[model samples]
Target: MNEQALSVREAIIGRRSVKNFNGQPVDLENINSILEDARWAPTHGLRNPWRFIVAANKEYIKFQDVLKEYGVPKWKELSEEELEKQMKKFRTPGAVVFVVVQEDARQKERLEDYAAASALIQNAMLLAWDQGIGTCWKTPPFIDNPKFREELGVKPGERIMSMLQFGYYDDIPKGRVRTPLEDVVTYYGIEENGEEK
Candidate 1:
């Protein structure tokens, strides 16, 4: 590992999921370029099932409304505190990529194929990291709501794998929790008879 390449690797390793954003408007051209890089991710059978959605004026309004449906009745009512919390949704690079898994007939286990497609989100995340943008790949109340999927133009058999929240960060992101490579790596496996072959 050369020093420069190692440093870049470390930078990626140090990336974190940032929640608080400055509400700064990011450059759309930069976002588009990042998406361009993201498309390079390997997909099975070249389905390119992932799709992106940028939350603009009306989209942002609909986003909040959909989020309201996921919470308690009081949240739907939206008190001042509730309203305050929801306001953060508006604050971002002003773009969101609704990574969807389009229905594919090629595979019996389509869910696994969808999962493979969802892996592209990491490519998008890392690309954003390189572009001085912070991201939060949210898969919460957003994914569980089927109606939002339809509203977002998702097809019948398709599903929302994740909601990638992108933005420029005013605050520095915190560190991450990672398991050591030594503990996780498995170099070789023993035989079925428990003999080291």
Candidate 2:
């Protein structure tokens, strides 16, 4: 656990998606703690639609072989140097989490489930940041492949929503500016002529 505690606003504003990890193994206990708290995220109909498949510590090493197969296609043909360079992305992360969500038969329920899972992901990211851990939510095309789904043991009637990576980083990436509310929002029923626009 980190000695310092950040306020919710600080965690939301300061957190950055870290792509450069230091390769230190993230404790499974810590990841569990984050998820335990994060599971409180809002879910429609009180259905907690998300679950995770995690690979950490020694397991991550084994996962590397799987990554080579899917993450880097034709990896065997590449030179040692080239393969190492390509594998760096997979190697650096201390842990990998595959977020899975139920795919309800009804369209509305399916969309709601996805939304709930997204909220859960955001909650986990914020919690991780507060603990001095960084996270990245990824959705690579391979996640949808049947082979990859089998590798993760994702069952039918469910979807892999995110490939979340958790790790430590030496640098705090600078935050980018977001679009101002004035540009992205419009007040309802507000007009110069006092008519709805």
Candidate 3:
């Protein structure tokens, strides 16, 4: 690769997930920039069904409480250490971006919208990375918790695709080794002798 391309590669490759955060607060401007860039991301039908729930205010606390009250097993039985751990989870970071998918038109349903929204989120992830911010795209425990979403005032027709969290480094996380592309991709071609070798 040329120097220009190499620099781009360096930025992309340097992006890492940071779970630990300091007391620094992420301003609304940067978060807005990330979301604004995300709006331009392509979608198949151009319905642009991606909506966001900004969980930066008291809403975050409300969501946390709802998650606890909803009885997630991990949160249900909390020793002092465990309770502290859970409380500290979101204490530091800047903002929690909930990527919610609005219901689809044409009866395609909301699932397709979520698929498209996930693409928008990738745009967001890269944007955050380019801006020297940390992110963790949480799902399952967070996404599947409807009670928590409701606390964030997510409307009835919406569901989560992913969450694009943003903050400065709590701790610089180590990047993991990615699997080689060759192992995951294949070219459809006949073997040398037309045998299945």
Candidate 4:
């Protein structure tokens, strides 16, 4: 389906974290379109701090190798077969995007940058979903490790926010339950003492 055919509400409410991919290659053009949509996400002061490192096709092999090497410290206790099984999971996605954000020295600016990058990720995910693609955004501890970050080409001033796995999937996951709006929202502006009018 074309991205324009999907409404914002459908994209927001229907998208799910897809774990199983059909193992088909997604076109580079579609991937670029998703990133372009992400580029339009709002940012404070127009910092446009988001950066992406995409791994696809033959690059996925190198990505899997890096995952295996970096994951060693965290998975030291696992058997070799177990480690291989885990690493194999990385191969299922058609592509993986490492989302990075440039950090600012000022705390508020840094926070805003992070928030903007998060919005960018959401935009990309929804855009992909609109095009009949699936995505999973993850923040594995190993990706933040110094050595791993260096291997992944993450610069000194940039922070990895998410590893977005994109692919085509045969399954459409059922919607998960969300907290009710009444339980999470509160309306004020009534009387003194913060009581509703």
The TM-score between candidate 4 and the true structure equals 0.89
Instruction: Rank the models by lDDT, top first.
Output: 2, 4, 3, 1
Off by over 4 Å in 2: 1-4, 192-197
- Of the candidates shown, which would achieve the greatest lDDT relative to the real structure? 2
lDDT of each: 0.69, 0.92, 0.70, 0.85
lDDT of 1 at 72: 39
Better of 1 and 2 by TM-score: 2
Under the 3 Å rule for N, CA and C atoms, how many clashes does model 1 have? Answer: 0
Estimate candidate 4's alpha-carbon lDDT, on a 0 to 1 scale: 0.85
Write candidate 3's Cα lDDT for 1-197 as tens digits. 11122244775687787778774667777787778877877776788887787765455555556545643457656897887676675666677787877776546645666667877787777777777778888775756666666767787777776766677884678989999996786556756455565
The residue-by-residue lDDT of candidate 1 on 1-197, one tens digit each, is: 11132254865786777787776655656667777877887776676777776664445546665556653346647787877676566444456677777777767558666766666788777777776778888877757566767777887877777787777778776677689886676557765566787
List clash counts for every candidate, in order.
0, 0, 1, 0
Question: Hey, what RMSD does candidate 1 come out at?
Answer: 4.7
Best candidate (score: TM-score) = 2
What lDDT score goes with residue 122 in model 2? 98
Give the range of the ten consecutive residues with the poorest summed lDDT in model 3.
Answer: 1-10
Q: What is the lDDT of residue 7 in candidate 3?
A: 49
Q: Local error of candidate 1 at 143, Å?
A: 2.1
